[model samples]
Target: MKRRLVRKLLFGAAFICLLSTQAFAQDGYRMWLSYDLIENPDKLSEYREMINYVSIPLSSPTLEAAGEELTPGLSGLLGEDIATTNQMQNGTIVVGTPGTSDLIAGLSLDDELNQLGPEGYFIEHRVVDGNHLMIIASNEEIGVLYGVFAFLRQLQTLQDLEGLSLKSSPKVEFRVVNHWDNLDRLVERGYAGLSLWDWGSLPHYEDPRYVDYARINASVGINATAINNVNADPKILTDQFLTKVAALADVFRPYGIQTFLSVSFNSPVDIGGLETADPLNPDVADWWESKVDEIYEKIPDFGGFLVKADSEGQPGPHGYGRTHAEGANMLADALAPHDGIVFWRAFVYDPAQTDRFREAYDEFVPLDGQFADNVILQVKNGPIDFQPREPFSPLFGAMEETNTMIELQVTQEYFGFDLHLAYMGPLFTEALTSDTYAKGEGSTVARVVDGSLFGYEHTGMAGVINPGSDRNWTGHPFVQSSWYSFGRLAWDHTLTAEEIAEEWIQMTYSTDEEFIEPVKEMMMMSRDAGVNYRMPIGLTHLYAQGHHYGPAPWTADLPRPDWTAVYYHKADENGVGFDRTATGSNAVDQYQEPVASRFRDLNRISDDYLLWFHHVSWDYEMNTGRPLWNELVHKYYSGVEQVREMQNLWNRTEGLIGSQRFEEVKSLLEIQERDAIHWRNACILYFQSVNNLPIPNGYEAPDHTLDYYKALEHTKYVPDPWYN
Candidate 1:
């Protein structure tokens, strides 16, 4: 009967509403580094015995931080304080670089240690003089810090430390979180209350949140973060704010998270009192160089500029009829002296009539190999914006000589804000694993961004962070998985969505298989479920204008045609879907070989991408034997059903996980149900008005008239900051 109850609860998400009670409310600022004590007696004892003593340097800031974290982390997990030792003894955990610890230098691990680059680590258990020892050694101090965190993670997840032999390293060079936070504390496209920076109190008041924030990021292998929005403000570079930014840098230095800024391209004109901010202008270049010198003085280890040049209304070299290479190269020259990088954003679109997906490629591919060595073009995962589903950006493999990185959005600006639990792990993995077919069939976007395919030096994966001042960090409990997913993937792109979700589950929630099994399944399916209910099967960017919360398929009122739903959908009386084939925009031609050919042929295209590449008639036959209109409608309904499945599964985990978090997720799931229905009803009805098609017999009818749904009174709703 208990098994039967579990089955019903797991599948149906029954009693989801019961999770909303006050008894379940929790402040979620801890994030994934919850050093909760282990309940398993055997594993706890083994872990305690393995890490009886820690021997690390007392001076190096990075090593000091590693010791601080390890001491508390082991104490919390083992339920006792661990002893430190200078002498090599049994059960001694020696953690340091070769230069710091002579014991580590004499390990004869030269060959094994060489495989781990500057920031990789090697953990091994050895015995000398019958003394059981665990050595966490690395080539650099930062690598030892990472190894220490790995050791703590084992404790957090209750993994046996006995005979632990593990070697790990980040595949990418730079892993950063790009915060779209403004100076006034307003987070653009942010849904979780306010920005986490607390600019008003910063530079003076050292908020403890900054410390924990760094700790959490370091635990996940994230090494850098840009505190400001990519749509930057020139004032951030001013002397006053630079001092403030430096203060935050001092706090993060110990944890190895470098600070970066999103620079306004027109800084010379806005802040330097210059007439023209042209890249070619000597005075403008001098101003940037002088300012970078000031920044480095205030913060020596600064990660350089993240420029959103010529994109949106942001100023760039385009104003002077200069190429993106000319613009990026100018800044790269300035930052090169300081060993800094320029993350030039490739999310560009002009007012001209063209496919939005093709614009970034057209502008960037021509400038390949022209950029300075330090300049890396930061490309979004998809060709289009961060839609529910999109083909990999054509620019990934197209630019061989240029360095590149992937930028993923963790905030659900278009995925239902903080109200829905849409895990983004699957979405991230899907884009990373997409085969670009640039060098060959195996030349994937992951390889392109990781810098292996192009044989380039720099590589990175950035997440537009979702963390805010909300009690739960991200307003929804399950939404935390996206944050975890981004960090884990940025460290190593090879990890599966399911693996990350399961690891996050063990650390973030419960370790019990019962709780983990269903929750892991829910997180894995969340992205697909959201795509189903919102924009499934390559139907991209059809959300309500401005707010982007609900459906607005009929909207064509935006200033730019490309900004509206009608621009991308191109739905009419004939059929629904865009045409990007040779007859259409020829965006498919941007891809190499077999990929382009497969996308061009209707018979060969994946059904998930049919609407993306080709415009089909309503009566056109689908792979599933359904007509185009019927298939589209079926997909929308299938997405809604998937959400219901998520809700039921979430509701059933109430007793297994913490009551407060369980109920919190339950309430979010309830909100998701309504949002999913809104997406389904509004989209189906509006499309029905155009196609004049009947709803399949099994699906539910529209909840209200199209006008009723359209009349959603949106008051001061601005989804994207640039929308205004």
Candidate 2:
């Protein structure tokens, strides 16, 4: 009889969801948090029966928020109102922190909860006196909040609730989202729209999107957010802005997201009216300490500060002849008193006689154990800015004694703004899964950042967020997958790209097999396609100067050679590709043992990284046994074919999803096809001009002249992002 009633309610929810399909179905404002009704009857029946009654008394704002989400998610899935009663009933779902409820404390789950840390939780099915119940217990209120979201995600993603045993702990200690938003509500490299923070009405009027942003992040186990751009302004450090930031802290605190800020390193001089902002100076240190104290007094739970010192023209202690460690440690000392950390970026570069790719490793490796315990060096995924395909930054395992955090760009600044549908999951997976060879063979980049390899004091992974004021959160609808993918991989790096893609697709779009299978294939292949057209065969940093939208392989006019395309491609009369071998930059020597030796050899390395470490002749043989020129031609043309294939595959989703989204994506596919052909033509024509070779037979010919591709104007492009 219980099974019958559960089945009836399960099917009823599906019926209601089908009827309410018009309820804001097209706009993607509600991201992966879309808890649509469960249509699968057998799985839904099991879940409905397991989640009948919920008992989570209001303990704190955090617990109240978690309990508030439970009823709506249950009602939306079961197609009926779930009652919250004082009395326990059959099939009750009890959720609470250990100290808040006697029923949970009696279970004595402290041992299990203690192992998972303060932010982890477990949901188990328990039986007492012939009554079966689902118990969600955690050691802290924040852990209970995470437990609630994880339980709801199972229903949202259509997972079976029978014999449900969910126990999860975030692998990385600090999973943060970094927003490149400015005080003027203008975002750099942001394609979605203007900034989400309304600075004009900030301290008083709060936006609803702020809470929703925290909700989506909490669902994915994200714990912190650096809410401003790293290229910060001194005005943001004033007391006026602290009150404005405190308002956002109030909204995010209940969701377990502690707010952080990007601070100007010269704040002592710029805001505090100091004569010198040297890290070693006593007056400078006192000013910073007082400012940090004031910040914590206003917002006690403030996470910390993210400083992009001495990178891309940002101010730093270098002006006063101080090392990066001295600068970082001084700020770390101030924040350490409040249990706060300082994320000092390792993206510094100069126009010295050195390879730009080897700069970060060179600067930070020697100062391995110099930083304070509370300081984490934030290194980009690649040594360079977020290129399409570059080797993992050698800084990962090089600094064993220093706490390191891997920083990733999810905003598609170089991958092509809203025009391209490139999923960043594969890129993130390739970097994380690469063998660092720090200690031995199994020492992956994941191990270094997760504090397992050298057992560091802190561990973190921060992604530069792609979100803006667009209705879909991210500009392109499919771009949301990258944001979701980053959060999942940060929580647990073992998750595969295929799993993340499937999970995101099932939540964002329809769960129909026909719709899922094809879209998943298209999503997984999107990254390689962009790489082929933009920067294939280990090529990096070949885009136009400012916007980075169009192809400009001939760009040689820039303030610095490292900022130009020719510096990366090295396309001269003799040959192409930068030589980073022992004969050249010797940057490959930074990696440990066999890993470095493998990259140094051409025959042993994969075709994906052939040109990265070595410069070969135009007639050199590749794995296909074809000459280098022939293979280069094929790879460039293959990129266009992939995009065309993606367009045809997307056409299959015409009737599966809403026409508004379907048509919007289809139009972007058209733009992508045009852009891919332009890239193939522009790059091949320029390389052919240098190699003095003809277009290989059976590939599309360039319609425009080489001079025409070079002459296209990109100097006046808007939004020059300070990628510090």
- lDDT tens string, model 1, 91-145? 8988898899988887888987999999999998899778899889999988999
The lDDT, on a scale of 0 to 1, for candidate 2 is 0.85
* Candidate 1 runs further than 4 Å off: 1-26, 713-724
Clashing pairs in 1: 12-648, 13-648, 19-663, 24-660, 532-639
The per-residue C-alpha lDDT of model 1 at residue 151 equals 82
Query: What's the residue-level lDDT of 361 in candidate 1?
Result: 91
TM-score of 2: 0.95
TM-scores of the candidates are: 0.94, 0.95
Candidate 2 local lDDT, 480-528, one digit each (tens): 9999999999999999999899999888887777888889999999999
Q: How accurate is candidate 1 locally (lDDT)?
A: 0.83
